[model samples]
Target: MQLEQILRERKEDKDILLMTHIVLGYPSFEANREIIRQMVENGVDCIEMQIPFSEPMADGPVILKANQDSLAAGTTVEQCLEFGAEMAATYDIPFLFMTYYNIIFKYGEEQFFARAKAAGIKGFIVPDVPPEMGTTFLKEAEKTDIAPILIYAPTSTPERMTHLDSIAQGFIYCVARRGVTGKKSEFGEGFNDYLALCRKSTRLPIAVGFGIQDKDDIKALTGRADIAVIGSQTIRLVDEHGPDAVGPFIAGLR
Candidate 1:
């Protein structure tokens, strides 16, 4: 099934769904494989396997460091793609390829799309490639059955959100705050208003990411958002603890 359909169907059983992001080959693909297993076994609904890049603009320190470290350690795009295929084949949950547009441009857009499709990847989260700049990327996404995940920021106007929804497929990744990933998010009045606009903007499921950590954060997104994304925190957990720490942490979120 398509990612949107899978996410929508998953929501029938749970009030909120969980999606996680991991920088492939951070510690190592060995650890990455294990991390994905723990996440999947502990009820993670979807996972975005980030192909590490040199300059990850959307990331904060933790993820930025991971990206740099992964690249420095000789992590290649082919390795990440192979790891993604392995995870998708092993886990029943939908897997997405998240990376910068430069990686796609260097790899050849349609070739990347074809490779991702062959790898069993269900979606692409190229944050740098907005629909306005990604005509071929969007078209290839449609043709290859890969969903091009669009993002909406807290500062986005209602009109802009509507425009995003027009070209967006799969789901809308609603960034919880104005900044990049890592810092913990505090859900309050402003967040509720932003979420309201997010809901009003798209028919696709809205996934609230950037600084979403711990059960309380997940609880806060319960009815308001369809999916709560866990990014840097998981990388932090793996760095601080080990791959085993992921399963228990994930199980307690809902």
Candidate 2:
């Protein structure tokens, strides 16, 4: 039941999985749990539990605010782990941690991956730590069997894609655009070409995120991508309409 295997199975069935993101302790611990339950019930295939950090450079305005607000409300790393452990145990889908490298560095990579594995986190999305600078981190991840998923941006060179393809585990996170997460992506011919290039690079499941919004966005990724990542938009909907809105919104996407 490793994450990579789950993704492969989904692909083999020709099912495009929905991968959702949530900033841990964003609104509150209790609320976050309910939100996750709703998402799973709505058919979310994987969950990315983002550990709120001070400077989440890869996040857009909405998620950045969520991170700051969570920190302001005294949401510590231990609380996130506790929340993650509970959710991972409750949900059958793959649970991965998405955070900046500094959090892992400060917490000690070995200890961090070990604790994440213990807490049922099957993988990680360390945005700042590219493969070249992640030798030790990868070593620890391999030892713990925690997949440190790599990312491929639209701007990545062929050589860069080849390098990333070599080490990517569970899945490859393909950022749809050049900027941070949020906004709506225009997945046209150019975006299709980018996805094609990414597919050529890695045999792992390619998850397209960063600006993915509605059902049309998911439809746009139907054949080319294995997973659709919806982050900021889902958070916004939950914040505006409460966690109850999440299930229906995800259902609409499906």
Best by TM-score: 1
**C-alpha lDDT of all candidate models, in order:** 0.93, 0.90
lDDT, residue 124, model 2 = 94
lDDT of 2 at 47: 93
Q: For model 2, how does the per-residue alpha-carbon lDDT over 190-233 read when each residue is reduced to its tens digit?
A: 98899999999987889999999999999989888999999999
Off by over 4 Å in 1: none
lDDT of 1 by residue, 57-133 (tens): 99999999999999999999999888888888888999999999999999999899999999999999988887888
Q: Which parts of model 2 are misplaced by more than 4 Å?
A: none
Colliding residue pairs in candidate 1? none
Instruction: State in Å the error of residue 68, model 1.
Output: 0.8
184 Cα displacement, candidate 1 (Å):
1.0
**Per-residue error (Å), model 1, residue 138:** 0.5
